[model samples]
Target: MLSMLRLTVITLLLAPQLAGAESLVSSLSDEAIEITSSFTGSRIVVFGVVRDEQETLDEAEYEIAIVVQGPESEIVARRKDRIFGLWINAASQPFFKVPSYYVVHMSENFSLVASEELVAQYKLGLANLNFVRSAYSPEARGFADAVIDIRRRENLFAERPAAVAFLAPNVFRTTFFLPAIVPVGTYRVSVFLFRQEKLLAAKTENLDIAKTGLSDNIARFARAQGALYGIMTVGLALFIGWFAGVIFRRS
Candidate 1:
């Protein structure tokens, strides 16, 4: 009777932990996206489920964040300053390992999802992104913010709160749009699960964006034969201009 009693106590202690041992299983709508002339934009849905669900929890208590990030590149951010009442590019800063594209979809607001340290560690939002340089100065920060503002206006960087939708207690999904100007490379789709400011599970998936058909050929040819490509572009422009004039004259 004593051994059975001990076993019962241990089981009771472990029950809650076992029930809450949830992990994420997720997939992207498209693993590969091809960019063509008609490729204006695309939408990707991240479908996910919490596996090993032994217990049901309040949907309000469950937190999820999904991020889609494009390839990283080094960039120069130039800031314009008003000189004699005319704004001109005055200062420039270089940033390394900055994402070319980044977007976030959150189940809740930033403060409600997790602590500041965890959010910054996981880059759950635009403000938490770690875009930095060797010199951490106020001027550099201004440059970085300028660059981010430009990207945000262009739909390259974004954050959407309450974007994740829960179909069931353990099932959820999110969808985000990729603009027509999305860069061509391998992007990462990251899904994170949180509860009471603690991370429960995380998953990452890869997405490929590449130029297809004539677009690919033209890009490659332009890189390989720069002078020839420039001449061809000029000729095409002139031909289009003359063609338009002739049509208008006839009309």
Candidate 2:
């Protein structure tokens, strides 16, 4: 009878921790790549969400990161610049790092990337900026292809409630980017999740880099404007008569 009573007490004690595990879930809601045009180099923003399944916790804590990889020979033409009277060298060569994870890697592909685990007990919350890296290569002047691996950290309770817990499942969102270049085609973006240094899940998506949309429109407009200016030399007039006419229309 005493053993059965102890068993019942233990079950009740472990109930909440187990319940907490069941309720804790994380995910990425907005997962995609954003492309923009620039004269010097390309820029892209990768955004997503880390949601908790159970509402019990005040907030779910996790980290988001990306593993970026691209062509190797493309990295060249490195330069140095002076900042605040100090000589600082900079590179057009591309590399990847996570500020929060404190992990850095350089590779032609996303194979050598690593994640910096956060200190146990603390949780990384929403709006947490994980990683950002930009590279400019001579070959990339025409086009370049790269991959991104997004990861999230999960928390799990340990046997001893006071003891540090283990990491649960890591959610991932991977994708690829291809800057404008010759012979565009569909590119594959792969994503994976790891738990305890082992991959647990994987997913892939395809990105098309065809010449259409705002980038093309803006390029066409710029060319047309430049040509018009060269041929006609038109300029905006600062005439009081025109200004008065515009104000009169609003009244």
Q: What's the TM for model 2?
A: 0.25
Cand. 1 Cα-lDDT:
0.73
Output the number of the TM-score-best candidate: 1
Shift of residue 248 alpha carbon in model 1, Å: 15
lDDT of 2 by residue, 1-251 (tens): 11110000000011122223221222223233333333222222222222334434434332222332221222233345688998777544343332211111111122222233331111111112222213244443222122122222211100111111113322222222223331223433222222233332333344343344577665556677977644443333445668889999999
* Regions more than 4 Å wrong, model 1: 1-20, 53-60, 84-86, 109-113, 132-135, 231-251
Model 2, position 200, has a per-residue lDDT of 29
Supply the TM-score for candidate 1. 0.78
lDDT of 2 at 77: 33
Error of 2 at 149 (Å): 22
